[model samples]
Target: MPELPEVEVIRRGLAPGLLGRRILRLVIGEKRLRRESSPEKFQEWLPGRVILDLERRGKYLLFRLEGGVTLLLHLGMTGRLLLGPGPSPPRPHVHLVLELEGGLDLAFQDVRRFGQALVFPPGAEPDPLAQVGREPFSREVTPEWLAQEARARSRTIKNFLMDGRVLAGIGNIYASEILFAARLHPGMPAGRLSPADWGRVLKETRRILNAAIAKGGTTVSDYLNSRGETGLFQLELSVYGREGEPCRRCGRAVARISQGGRSTFFCPRCQKKK
Candidate 1:
């Protein structure tokens, strides 16, 4: 699935083309996504509304439309949002296509069919974003705040960071990179981290996430930008996918371990266990 950085890249790519464009029609696929709005509801609420702005919360994309309606999209694993001239190519799993006024087709293609599309009315809070925590770069996510929330949690530090409810937009890939950058072991307990350790974690988290966004996010299998380009961040990964490979900081080989069913990669010598 696309994380925060990947989704942000998509938002930036699509905003200019989508903004000020009114939806002339919505074409629903025969196959349904994980969650989808009814065809009648889509037709009634979507057409004639102009896209005013595009916003991203966690991994969800919000298309602010005229008249207080918001078009919500979640590009689940193997999903791609592409902007193309005229009608899109006849693809196998194109779930939703928005025919815009200026001869543009906003296509939502999901090979795995795990994506979600919904139309939210004015003043309505999206359920997927309801429990999302603060942005990593936000001022509200200080070391003190992270320590406070982690004080009672016995989960591993990696798991804690990956939890969307605690810190939105981080997934397996970035969690490992952040931990590696902070020089912390993934198996360390969240509650055991000191405030100073939390400080390092927070700092590295922001730095890594920002760098990932600049590189267009990590393409670890099924992630692509709105222009169908693979991410460059994976080329610069420190430890996430370099299992058994030599560590950049230390001479020792990078190690891989499974936690909560997700693979974590780090340098055993550099990221000391406490």
Candidate 2:
């Protein structure tokens, strides 16, 4: 799945092509996308309207429409947004296509078919996008919020970070990276942290997330910018996916462990249990 940074990158990429354009046609090829939010309704609300702007909350993408409605898209996994000339022979899994007034069509393709395209009217919110806890990139998500959520939580730091209810948008890749940078073992309980530890974790989380956004997010698989280009952040990864490799900071072998059924990589010496 595309994380926050990757989703943000796609949002920025689509803004230039989408905003100010009128939709001439709307096509929804896939059915069974989040209940009651179908392609027919999407086309009905979208074809004649203009795209006001685009925004992202956590892993969800929102397109503010002319009718005060919002089009919410969750790129669950293997989903991609592509823009190009019309009728580019529908690639496999090209489930939804929006033909713009300029004869250009925006195609959303998903190989795994796990992604969903939903149409939400004004104040008619969807749960998956609404349940996220915070805007990790905004001032709203402060160190105080992080510290408060960490208090009395016995879950592993990695698991805690992945919980969107506690912290928004820090996914598997960033969780490992943040834990490595904070020098906290991924398996450590969140409540064990002192004020100083919370400070380190919060600071490093922001630092790492910002750096990843700057580098255009990690390209572990199938994630692409608007123009279908792979991201470059994978090359900058220090711990995640480098298991058994030499740690950049400690030279000890990076270890991989399963946390909540997800693979987490960390430097043993640098992020050892405290």
Candidate 3:
């Protein structure tokens, strides 16, 4: 699934092509996405509405449209939103297509069919964004604030970081990298972290996420920018998929462990349990 940086990259890529362009029509696929608005609703609310701006909240993409309606999209695992010239050849699993006024078409393709495309009415609060927690770059996300929130929480630090309700947009991939950079074991209890540990985590989280966004996000699989380009950040990965490879910092074999059923990679010598 596309996380924060991946989704943000898509938003930035699509903004130039989509902003100020009216939706001429909408093409809904025969098969439904896991979460999608009805074709009737889409057709009713979409056409003639111009896209004013694009924003990303957590992992969801928000198309701020004219007249105040918002089009929300969630790229579940294997989902891609591709933009192309008019009437391009059909590809497999293209769930939704937004026909723009400038002969450009924005297509949403998903191999796994687990994505979401929904239209919310004016001033309507979508449920997907309601559950997302604080943005990682927000000013309110200080180390002391995180420690206060984690107080009495017994989940592993890795699991805590992966929780979208606690820290939005971080999935298994970035969680592993952030923990390794902070030199904290994945299995350490969340509540056991000190202010200093959280300070490192916060600093590293911002640095890693900013770096990933700059590189267009990590493309382990099924992630592509709006231009259908693969992200380059995977080449810079230190621990996520380097199991048994020597750690870049300590020269020790990188390690892997399962947390919440997701694989987490780290350098055992660099990341120690407290």
Candidate 4:
């Protein structure tokens, strides 16, 4: 699934191509998604309205429309958004297509069919990103705030970061990367962590996320930009997928463990259990 940086990259890529232009055609090939919102409702509420702007909340893309309506999209595992003009062959899983004012066809292709498309009529839906925990880049998300939150919770550190209720925009891949950057163990109990540990986690979270945004996000498998280009951040990862390989920080072998049913890579020596 596309995480926060990936979603942000999508929003940035789609902004120029989608802004100002009117959505002439609305096509929906699939409707089964996380929410109960239907394709028909999307076409009904959208189309004629101008695309005011593009917004993102957590992992969801919010295409703000005229009259305060928002089109919510979640790119589950294999979802891809392709844009541009000229002759372009459509993918086999092109589920949604929005015809622009000209002759452009902005397509939403998803092979896994786990993505979602929903319409939020004026204030009907809240911004999931804004509703989640303090953004790492936000001024409100200070090291002290992270320490307090960690001190108040008893969940594992990695799980705490991944929980949308505690903090939004962090997925499995990022949680591992962030922990590696902080040299902290994923399975460490949150409340048991020292203030210094919390400070390291918060600082590294911002550093890693900013570096990712600068690199256009990470593309481990199927993630692609609007232009079908892969991201450049994967090369900078320290322990995300280097399982069984040598750790970047230490010479010890990087190990992979199943936590919360997800594969997490970390150096046992570097990130020791407390």
Candidate 5:
């Protein structure tokens, strides 16, 4: 699935073309995504509404439309939001296409069908947003806040970081990278981290996320920007997929371990368990 940075990249890429463009029509695919609004609902809320703004909350893309209707999208694993001049190519696995007024088509393509496309009417709150935690770049996300949330939680630091309800938009890829950058073991208990340790984690989280966004996000697999360009951040990865590779900091072998059923890559020498 696309994490925060990847989603943010897509939002930025699509904003310019989407804002002020009215949805001319909806081209619905035969197959359905994991979570999607009904065709009737989509048609009722989306067509003819001009896109006012594009925003990203956690990993979800929000298209604020005229009359306050919101179009929400979540690119699940193997999902790509592609923007192109119409007529769009006959691409396979495209679940939805938003035909715009200026001959542009915004298509939601998901090979695995795990993506989400929903439209909320005016005054209706999106249920998925209720689960997303604070943005990593928000000023309110201090080290003290992270520590307070982790209090009494015995989950591993890696698992804790991956929980969207606590800190939104982090997935396995960024979790491993953030833990490695913080020099904190993925296996350490969340509650065991001191405020200083939390500070390092928070700092590195913002740094890595901003860096990934600048590089257009890490495209280890299916992720791509709206322009269909692959991200460049994978070339700069330190530990996420470099198992048995030498650690850049300590010259020790970068290690891989499983936590909460996800692979974690870190330098054992640099990120010592406390």
Candidate 6:
């Protein structure tokens, strides 16, 4: 799945070309995505509307169009949004294509068909936004806030960090990295964390997320920028995907464990359980 940083990278990459362009037409594919609005709905709300702005909420991309209509996209595991000149050759797994006024085409391709494309009319709030919590970079997010939210919660710290309802845009990859940086064990119960512990987690979360965004996100598999470029952050990974490799800090073998069915990588010596 494309997490916060990956989605943010896409938003920044596409914003320059997408803003102010009018949607000339909608080319719908025969195959349907996991969550998509009807072709009639898309055609009715999208064509002839100019793209006013591009925004990202959690892992969802929001294309604000003229007359207050919003185009929402969620790039599931293997989804890619590629932009190129029109009259381009047909590619496989392209489910939606928006023909722009400048002869440019914005195509959404997902081999697994798990992505989402939805259109929301004026005054209608996107349903997916309701599920997204505060962004990690928000000033409102503080150690005190995290402590309050995790109060009485028995879930593991890793699971707490991965919960989109509490902190938006965090997934398995960043969760492991953030916990590793904070020197906190993934299996530690959420309620057991002190305010100082939460402070370290919050600081490292912002640091790692900003670094990932700067590096254009981690491309472990199918992630690509609008220009079809792979991310460089994977080369800087510390623990994730480095199972049994020596830890960069402690020189101890990096460990991998399963939490909530997702692999979590950390240093056992550094992130000792309390």
- Evaluated at residue 181, the lDDT of candidate 6 is 95
lDDT (Cα, 0-100) at 133 in candidate 6: 93
lDDT tens string, model 2, 1-274?
A: 7887788878877898999888788777744543337655776677788888988888888888887888788887888899888865667777788898787788888877788788877777666765887877677766677777878576888898999877777889989988999999999988777788888888898888787777777788678777777745564888888989999997999999999999999987898798
Best by lDDT: 6
If both were scored by TM-score, which would come out higher, candidate 4 or candidate 5? Answer: 5
lDDT of each: 0.89, 0.81, 0.90, 0.80, 0.91, 0.93
Candidate 2: 10-residue stretch with minimal lDDT? 30-39
* Per-residue lDDT of model 4, residues 70-177, tens digit only: 887788888888886733365687777787787777788888778777777897775444556756677777767777887887788889899876677899888999
- Please give the RMSD to the true structure for each candidate, in Å: 1.2, 1.7, 1.0, 2.1, 1.0, 1.0
Number of clashing pairs per prediction, in order = 0, 0, 0, 1, 0, 0
* Model 5 ranges off by over 4 Å: 231-235
So what's the TM-score on candidate 5? 0.98
The pairs that clash in candidate 5 are none
Deviation of model 1 at 27, angstroms: 0.9
Cα lDDT tens digits for candidate 5, 142-223: 9999998898577989999999988889999999999999999999999999989999999999999999888888788677
TM-score for candidate 1, residues paired by index: 0.97
TM-score of each: 0.97, 0.94, 0.98, 0.91, 0.98, 0.98
lDDT tens digits, residues 1-274, model 6? 7899999999999999999999999899999999999999999999999999999999999999999999999999989999999954699999899999999999999999989999999999898899999999999999999998888567999999999999999999899999999999999999999989999999999999999889888898688888777755563888999999999999999999999899999999999999
Q: What does the lDDT read for residue 259 in candidate 4?
A: 91
Candidate 1, poorest ten consecutive residues by summed lDDT: 226-235
Q: Residue 191, candidate 2: how far off, in angstroms?
A: 1.3
